[model samples]
Target: MRPKLLAAVLCLTLFGCASKQVVPTHNESRVQAEASLKAAESAGASRVPEAAQHMEFARQQIADAERLLVEGEQEAADMRFRQAEADADLALALARSIPLEREAQRATQQAEAARRSLQ
Candidate 1:
């Protein structure tokens, strides 16, 4: 009886470890999206509109993922979550580039004016 009990305990422990290794895709996507959103927010405030939109979309995806996860459709949920994160990152990159682009344009204009004056 003691040996049987020990074997059961060992099996339970192994199962628990295995479960921990199986990270739900939705959770990973959610985390990545959140991180991207934070980066977008930090890059500049002018990107608020795009950032807000991305955040809203991400929230919706996360909600869907949660529902799917609850329904035991983990693989689908994970795919959606990854898509949400990609969308958020794209938005963030777009926002961060706006200011840089504007600066570049201004610099080019200034340089052109200087060249004209020199000529």
Candidate 2:
């Protein structure tokens, strides 16, 4: 009887360990997206408005994902997270365009010229 009890306890411990862990909060996903956006901007991205729009969209998706996760819809939440990630990637690509970069450079030069004139 003691051996049977030990076996049951061992089985329970193993099962507990094997269960999937809880998903992280939506804030974490937003933070990750924001970090990616900052990295892209630091790398000379110029389409700030477009990137901002995409970031907003990603934020919405993350909210949805979080809601689904809270409702125990793990698969749906995962899908939303994937979509949010894709949106962030799209924003990064748009921000990295050469035309936008050139526009940003021209704007920076103009601003510097204005500053110099004021000085």
Candidate 3:
């Protein structure tokens, strides 16, 4: 039991001390982020000031990720790419809500009219 415990501890320690090794496959993430940003833009995110911040943040994050990638920081680049993607997604979602808001307003007006007719 003592030998087994020692072996397990040694294995854990060795694994813990090992340097993190991640493949530099950030190209896919970069592409995904860029596509998302473009989608948000094409979806009229810029037209809605509410999503402007998200679109800007996403752009900045993509730039930073590119810089980090050039600096050979794969992990940081990947994180930034993911962040950019999320921001872009938020911007797109906000842009999409515009039509939904209009629909809801129209529905409310119809409901008000129906109630007035009943009265």
Candidate 4:
């Protein structure tokens, strides 16, 4: 019974160590970030000040992540990739919101004008 328990403990310890060796790569996050950046650009993020800033940040983060990956810093690279993805997504959302905001402003103006006329 003691030998069986020892063997089980050894196996668990080895398995845990092996699992730690499996470094996670963020390739999918990188891909998603690139896609989001492209979509933001397509949505005219470059024309929006805040959105452009976020887009630039995303690009920088991606570059940094790539460098980290080459340096074998898988955890740091993964974090940067995720940050890049978030920035790109935020940029896209901001770009999309600009047009909607303009539309809302126009509608508000129209409503005000109609109210004035009725009064």
Candidate 5:
């Protein structure tokens, strides 16, 4: 009984010390950030001031992430990549909103004109 117990404890200790692979998030986040940036550009964020600012921020964050990756700071690199993706997404939204805003203003004017005619 004593021998079996000792063997069990030794096996448990060895298994606990076994190294496991650490999957890095840097690559995944980097891919997401790039995609977001492309979407923002396609939405014409470069032509919209507000969106352009966010898009620029996204680019900078991505650059930072890459630098961090080179430095072997996987966790920090992952964070920067997430930040970049967020900024790019915001830029895309803002770019899309510009055209929608114009349409809204046009509708408002048409409504006012119809109201005046009715009066």
Candidate 6:
């Protein structure tokens, strides 16, 4: 019984140490989220309604992440930052794609008109 208890304590101690090691002391996720948000804004996410909504959500997530960090909730804060980054990235993509989609539609219309004229 004594040996079993000692082994269990040792295993728990090792597990605790390993878990602590896995958590990062610095919040790189926050930095990435901020960068992504900035990129999204630069891409003109506000002009597209969906992108704008995502950007706003990202901002809120970032704010929440900051608050979490203040409360010593590093893991939660990091997760929030990651979520914000994803939203911002999505916003950026939408902002870029909408214009391209419009252009593609216009080109397709022109092609159809040209074919009809040739006929």
Per-residue alpha-carbon lDDT of candidate 6 for residues 5-67, written as tens digits (9 for 90 to 100): 999999999999888745544368888888999999999999999899999999999999999
lDDT of 2 by residue, 57-101 (tens): 777887898899889987777777777777777777877775567
Instruction: Please provide, for model 5 over 1-119, each residue's C-alpha lDDT reduced to its tens digit, 9 standing for 90 to 100.
Output: 99999999999988887855656577888999999999999989999999999999999999998999899999999999999999999999999998799899999999999999999
**TM-scores of the models, in the given order?**
0.61, 0.49, 0.70, 0.74, 0.74, 0.73
Worst 10 residues of 4 by lDDT: 21-30
Worst 10 residues of 1 by lDDT: 43-52
Candidate lDDT scores, in order, read 0.75, 0.75, 0.92, 0.91, 0.93, 0.91
In candidate 3, the residue pairs with backbone N, CA or C atoms under 3 Å apart (3 or more residues apart, or in different chains) clash, namely none
Worst 10 residues of 5 by lDDT: 17-26
Off by over 4 Å in 4: 1-24
lDDT of 2: 0.75
Error of 2 at 21 (Å): 18
User: Model 4, residue 54: what's the lDDT?
Assistant: 98
Model 4 lDDT per residue over 1-119, tens place:
99999999999999999888654458877787889889989999999998999999999999999999999988888999889889999999999898799999999999999999999
Pick the TM-score winner: 5
Show how many residue pairs clash in every candidate, following the order shown. 0, 0, 0, 0, 0, 0
Ranking by TM-score: 5, 4, 6, 3, 1, 2
Give me the displacement of residue 57 in model 1, in angstroms.
3.5
Q: Which stretches of candidate 6 lie over 4 Å from their true place?
A: 1-26
User: What TM-score does candidate 5 reach?
Assistant: 0.74
In candidate 1, stretches whose alpha carbon ends up further than 4 angstroms from where it belongs are 1-25, 45-56
Q: State residue 119's C-alpha deviation in candidate 4, in Å.
A: 1.7
